[model samples]
Target: MLRFLEVFAKGSQIHVPVGSPLIRKIPIFVDEHDVTAGAMKLIKVLRPAWDTSDVKTKLFTDGTTNKLVGCYVEDSPEDVVLVRVYGHKTELIVDRDNELKSFQVLHANGCAPRLYCTFLNGICYEFMQGDALGTQDVRDPSLRRLIAGEMARIHAIHAHNGCIPKPNLWIKMRRYFSLVATEFTDQASNVRIQQEVPSKAVLEQEMAWMKEHLSTLGSPVVLCHNDLLCKNIIHNEKDGHVRFIDYEYSSYNYQAFDIGNHFNEFAGMAELDYGLYPSREMQMDWLRVYLQAYKLFSQKGEEVSARELETLYVQVNKFALASHFFWGFWALIQAKYSTIDFDFLGYAVLRFNRYFETKPAAMALQIPQ
Candidate 1:
């Protein structure tokens, strides 16, 4: 129980005992007016505690300005509600509305936590009293199938509604890539990054070429959880089902990119364990099962042909290039402004190296021109 008190554990952040009576007085540190209002409303729904009851707000600090408040009421001490105060880093502009809506949609489908309310800069949602999936959990054959099935289910969801704008992945990448000149720092790292990875001019050319070819790929474009890092998959130990959190990167994109990014995740979790990266055969095996699940979920699509499957296999391998490049630039931008202790520049180099590493494999495939 004490071990779960920390935000991230060694391999995984396991479930914590939330409802137990071994209560302690944690500080009710809150500043944002919207957060307070959101928390009070959640409290009201939990019980009639405004009249007379002890209320406590527990804080979860992760070194970022974003405020995470756990609202606990006297009547329902066990039922904890988390208030996510959206403190947007000026450098990173995520659509708060899109993120909230994505969360709600996934929650409705039982793919994410139950969202409660949205305010000025944040939203309150159900906190999963569970553990994060470990590196092995993601690599195991059976578990990988289960996760693939879950991703298939997510992709089946319609991204844009009547007025909601669909995500423009090309524009998004262009926007991220635009920051390279201004964001990348550390002359030594810049020199190393330049020598090891594609130069900005080369990347722009590659991106243009990739975009032209990928748009014509046979696979259907569906809602993609673009970032499938291992840390984001939450496993409910009680039932063996996993729910994905962090909707900031979820958007409408090519199915291949989503699957490729996930396969890319198999390369490593916290650190680069390229040795753990899946073999081509293993990736294809998972893709087949994923397609089966996708077939079941997508009612309108015709049965996948062997040729379609082969195309997808090749396309996924190629899209792997885009995934690495996407994150490589992302790491460079994050390295510029992020306050976290992790070495963003070094991580940027790693992602860039992965981009180069995957390029040859993509070249070998007879993908769409």
Candidate 2:
């Protein structure tokens, strides 16, 4: 006995019944005017149309100018529409265009949800309906193997008409880390920490590690979903398949980085505030399956060996170190900006220590010349 509402902005008002199932069948619509009014207007319209008394909406951003707001209705089985608003009009348009392009690519490959519509300021797609696979489930051998295989399948599709964007992994990481370090350093003394700033010495050490291992990382970059986390993965029980959502971080990078990131998420070591005992045996099993699947689709797979896989594992550990350090610094700054609580800094510190504990073994895995 539940109904859905479709609220869209056009030159004139387009209305459908408040309790119509047709609303659930169509995508939410927005135009240039919708972005101008911000997300509030949309929420206001939805509130009455959906006849919800306990609906709440909130916005979240990573200190970036572009913000996305999620509108959730309590105790409702209706679709959720995420409204993205950007500080700068130009930036908003550009982001929407990129989203449309990315959605088209996935749709063409028959791998993702269909894009329902778009506008000058934003785009909308079918909401993925399923249960999210949590960190523990993603770490399972069978599930990890399946995930690895699907990722390879996604990467195998050549960029349409052989067009590819420049790989920006290293550059983006450098900028992100720089911002984090500067922000944390400004607030170090306030937290009663003797070492107020992230040690520049540590950053230099990680940079040196990356420079030293560049040659062995991988060759001919492949498409990478750089931000593979547990929440981004959805499990469709009906079809028994795993689907990855959120491509805002998609780019071309060394395939090994993707593998390492997935492992890091499964290990649940990113939070740094908590300890995890991810099974090494399970880790190895996932790696073997991933590499095998990669080989099935990659030309370079023919040259890959077990030793190479071990080496990649070590290198990924280095990447993990750098990533952990970057996020720790980020958390520190976030605390200073009042964007987060003091616990953020503590979590960063704990993660850094854990990475340090594992660094020696990771380094020892480096193959001899």
Whole-model lDDT per candidate: 0.67, 0.55
Query: Which pairs of residues have clashing backbones in candidate 1?
Result: 19-78
Superposed model 1: Cα runs more than 4 Å off: 1-78, 87-93, 161-167, 184-198, 300-306, 367-369
Residue pairs with colliding backbones in model 2 are 272-351
TM-score of each: 0.76, 0.67
Candidate 2, residues 287-316, lDDT tens digits: the string is 666667777776655445778667656666
Best by TM-score: 1
True-vs-predicted CA distance for residue 20, candidate 2, Å: 31
What is candidate 2's TM-score against the reference?
Answer: 0.67
Model 1 accuracy (lDDT, Cα) = 0.67
